[model samples]
Target chain A: MCIVCGCGHAEAGTGEPEHDHGHKHHHSHGSRLDFGGGPAGVSLPGLDQARILRIETDVLAENDLIAAHNRAYLSEHGILALNLVSSPGSGKTTLLVRTIADLKDRFPIAVIEGDQQTSLDTERICATGVPALQINTGKGCHLDAHMIDHALTTLAPGQGSLLLIENVGNLVCPAGFDLGEAHKVVILSVTEGEDKPLKYPNMFAAADLMILTKTDLLPYLRFDADRCIDYARRVNPKIGILRLSSETGHGLAAWYDWIEARRIPVSQQED
Target chain B: MHEMSLTNGILRILEDQARTRNFSRVRTVWLEIGTLSHVDPEAIRFCFESTSKGTIAEEACLVILEPAGQAWCLDCSQSVTVTRRGDPCPICGGFMLHVTGGEELRITELEVE
Candidate 1:
């Protein structure tokens, strides 16, 4: 028994009679591979008889559990939560500002802005005459499901309303975490590299839609829209693509249409 | 990096297992990471080594098993091996490949006492 925790074998690494041997052995018999072969020990000293315990589990299980709770809660309340992800300066805030401006009267809209620092994005979102909350992650790269759960309790968006979560401006880390949104929408501006989808295939693969922002600058820049679309499709064949210029109000109608089409009603009927 | 989060998750699992299974310490961790999972094994190792300190899994050894990514080719009607996400089918050389396997990042086993 462990002297420290009183669980097993006197803490495995302390100076016990079990520490006198050079227990290092690597042998495989049949299909089982044995290590040390006596008893499984801790970090040092005795590796003679270590026990192998099979526990097949995902590392993100905890996060995924919380995300599932968020999903069920949102679905029950007839809420449409969209997770917006993009690299820095991809015009997510600008596009959101425009989108909220146009759709605020049509339905109730709330925003949850995530950033490492500063409430500037949340401030911009609130300026549109809509309720918005800012979650500063401090050192976190992306917002997790637990944070979203807290934000939901604090925000308390109306039933059958739209909730937009603008994730920290990152193309990489956010792809791995599921925030229990209806869909993950990745925004890429024309000013950036057209091959971003290929460069960050994980994000493209995880996203349900790819919004090509800053289309008004297409004439001034040499960004190839067709190639960009091809690359995005290469990663995710079913990803919906949209081209919009928030500055010129070019393709906002289609975007708003997409949102309205997916918004779940309080008594939504299933097909 | 998200590897940090993944490592923290591994630690959480280890601690939880220790409590339930009545293990005092963890000696080694066996993880199966897919080639196309976008999780670098080296980065995971580094993150685990750093974060596992002062925890029940402190000084625990990490053993990573990388499985090859496999994709199904719609044009060829065959499954082919892929190393990256956007790689075309090796047999048909077409881009109509859908990933079918090898996106797992799971802990398969543990050595504890």
Candidate 2:
């Protein structure tokens, strides 16, 4: 397991091998485990005593740095990168499949699919005749910026192309990690509780746009659309909302139009 | 849990600091986690204990400081303290509460030898 994030796959870091923690440092219940109990709190002869360092550093600084690099690279290439976030069973893959099929003629597209242990979504995207890559995070629930950094090399999306990253089907963990995308598009289905916005406020707040998927079933389900929007707005007043059903092809034009409007201008494209 | 990842992040930071500052081990870590950061302090404690093993921070003391959540209510035009998200303005009872603080997940200080 990657010790940095406890994700099943080990991406690169200090490259230290795993160690067994069980040792002869047994202490009483009330006693402290003092590894530097020498005079002046010193453990080594050459080093000084223990001193406090005011680091004031963000815990996720490493990830954020890598994400910033990714943002720079994508910006240099003028790629419209979107990180798609949602829970499992929200029809994210289905929506992607439909979106790709409809927009293939308009733009060059590629996909990077993130899942704990599956290549199924990548296969579905490839079926649409567009290049796609799958990242199996193993036990990792969310995709980090470092992983995205490596995938960018293999995917090598062309300039001005649309890059869609289907993050692991999770709402809570993905919110904290920035994947260097232009926007975080969260997909919520009508089948789930409308109060999801209230329940997972971080995801709702982090998202730039909330796509209500499976809207065709709204007639059968008692999902309150207004209440859901109200809750989402309560969390993020500026978040954009779009409702669409990939099955019936309803409200898809607006979704496409949204993408078109956000596309980077060709004149600003770089090699 | 996301806390596992966060614990690892803390470890990485410690190791990086150790390399630059020529420290061998970490004695204690003081983390400032805000109430609105979506990070659970208890979960972080559990993960830290389990993941810090066999590392420089093994058996190290973790001090968590939870700062109160603060938000600006547009309706009342004043800042108010909130415990969590979706909270209405304490004074005006409106939904225009914009969070301004308590989302910090930072390692403020560390004791190393």
Candidate 3:
């Protein structure tokens, strides 16, 4: 397992042996049996008194530090960075493809695709003739600040450009990690349950915008758009709600307007 | 699922402390996980054991302190206890509750040698 993110890299577990940071040490002692036993089963013995150090450190401090640096870097470059998060099969990539095609002429758009194993999403984004970088996180669930910092170096989006970071298809973990995006846009497909916001409140609460995608399927399916928005509002009253369908181009204009509203004006970009 | 990454975070902290504090082995780790932090204590324990293997914190005792979620009810204008993130304010039954506390994930103290 990679110690940084605990990614097992279950598939194609070859040629990356150096990434595996953990050592497979088979100790006979169990976790339950090792409590306050005076370190009897410790691998390193002959230690003195157990010093109680009052550290009180935040676990995500390192990631947050890197994320701060990324935010500053993006702000200095006048890049409108958006971190797109959603569950699997939410048509996030399709939405990105459509968004890119719609605004590519007006703005220099780039993408950073994150997934556990394949470069498929990156390839799909690159088909739009935009520079895209694929970050295979292996078993890592979400993209962290450090990963985004590294991706920024390679996929260097132009000044005053839009950087769309498509996070891995998981709603939970991505909510916690700040990828230095100006706003987090979370997508909830209408095909899914309406009570998803209640089930995944953290993700809903963390998002600046809650995009209700696949609205074209709403008529065919028994999905309540109002109730879903209400549920999302229950978690985050200030969250902006947008209903769009990438397939039929429904509500795409409003989505485009929303993006344009957040963009820094060309005149201000010089500042 | 994300606990694996969190365990890695803990491991990094332990490694840093070992170098600065001059400790070769970690005996116990006291973690303060809040209810709204979205991290399961059991899953963290399991992941920590696996990720900390061959590290300075291998076989270390993990003492997790889970604090209950607390929120400020906008309707009632009072502080209330909440166990879950989406749960309404217990007193007023209002969903307009702003989270006030219990979202911490920190390593409070460590027993090292």
Candidate 4:
């Protein structure tokens, strides 16, 4: 009760300064509990010295869940899903066209091309007569599960299909999210520098395999092959490295063999 | 970055939790970003704010905790704490280090009013 107002109670009322609502939650024991603010005058009970996690793990966890769904879906259908990541103009589409041209008769290949705009990459793949769908990311830089889920419906059903999900040309964000690909392939051109792996370690670290594209231009560029492999190994020693050039038809056979090896069903694959 | 989708995920969780508990508003959201996760905290903040727009997590204070990374050293035969994944094992200067932990991104707690 204020001395000026002369009310019946002391320091008590609805939080609103108004006529009584007739009901008040009392400090039954006359003790008030303090929420945590103690760390910076913001400490809560039972959290004073304990390791408190203020994490919203919803994003990555959700992605993992979706990735699991994608993996199971693709595996069940006998689809070999590959997520291709690289810097722009690292010959992703050109390489795909060449690979499809060579292997079109042996396997049913499909391409889900992701780009910020334009259906150019999809058109390139269509030339090979393989089923291809363009995923215009609008302004988005990475491909996620929902996009692939929708693209699978629009494109050939990936069941029993070799699906190549060419992600929007980026070295970063695509490495973080799994688009349900059976394996992640990071393509790098000889001109992109051997230090590219060091600068973007996460990409190299996450990749199941790394392809050094444009190996035909190796003589013209002053790129060191040994140093490039070293950088990638520093980040991820487990990633398989293949050097290839679509123009020279070099390393294409190895690339095909690598893809085939990973696709062998676990039931048949020798442990 | 992919903040909008992350915001959507958070909102979905918040809505689901609120529905079962009869909560109206989320006062705060606690987030953990691992050291090796490579997501920008400032970017997440900006993305969360922009993506939230009238969702359960809208304008909720985003609290971030940086988790320490752990790696298994081939030479040491034991796990060692490190700053980031893919870092050399602190115990043994071996290149064959396997990451054991610290790639955490999660929602551990929430404050509701």
Top candidate (lDDT) = 2
Per-residue lDDT tens digits for candidate 2, residues B39-92, read 899999999999999999999999887766788888788888888888777788
Instruction: Give every prediction's interface RMSD.
Output: 8.7, 8.3, 8.6, 13.3
Candidate 4 lDDT at B15 equals 83
Question: How well is each residue in B32-108 modelled by candidate 3, as lDDT tens digits?
Answer: 77778878889999999888889988899988766667778889998888888777778877789888767778886
lDDT of 3 by residue, A14-95 (tens): 3333222121211222232222333322122343434766577889999999999999999888899999999999999999
lDDT of 4 by residue, A1-271 (tens): 2111112224432342332222112221114432234222223453332222232235566677878887777777788899999999999999999989988787678999999999988888898898999999887889988788888767755445678889999998788888888888999999887898888887888898999999999889899988999888877878899999999998999999987776646464222
Please, what's the RMSD in Å of model 2? 10.7
Off by over 4 Å in 4: A1-57, A265-271
Q: What's the true lDDT of residue A179 in model 3?
A: 89
Q: By DockQ thresholds, what CAPRI class is model 2?
A: acceptable
TM-score of chain A of each: 0.82, 0.82, 0.81, 0.78
CA lDDT of each prediction against the hidden true structure: 0.84, 0.85, 0.83, 0.74
DockQ in order: 0.34, 0.30, 0.29, 0.26
Candidate ordering by lDDT (highest first):
2, 1, 3, 4
Model 1 agreement with the true structure over A31-110: per-residue lDDT tens digits: 44333343432333443334666677888888899999999888878889999999999999999999999999988999
TM-score of each: 0.86, 0.86, 0.85, 0.82
Write down the DockQ of candidate 4: 0.26
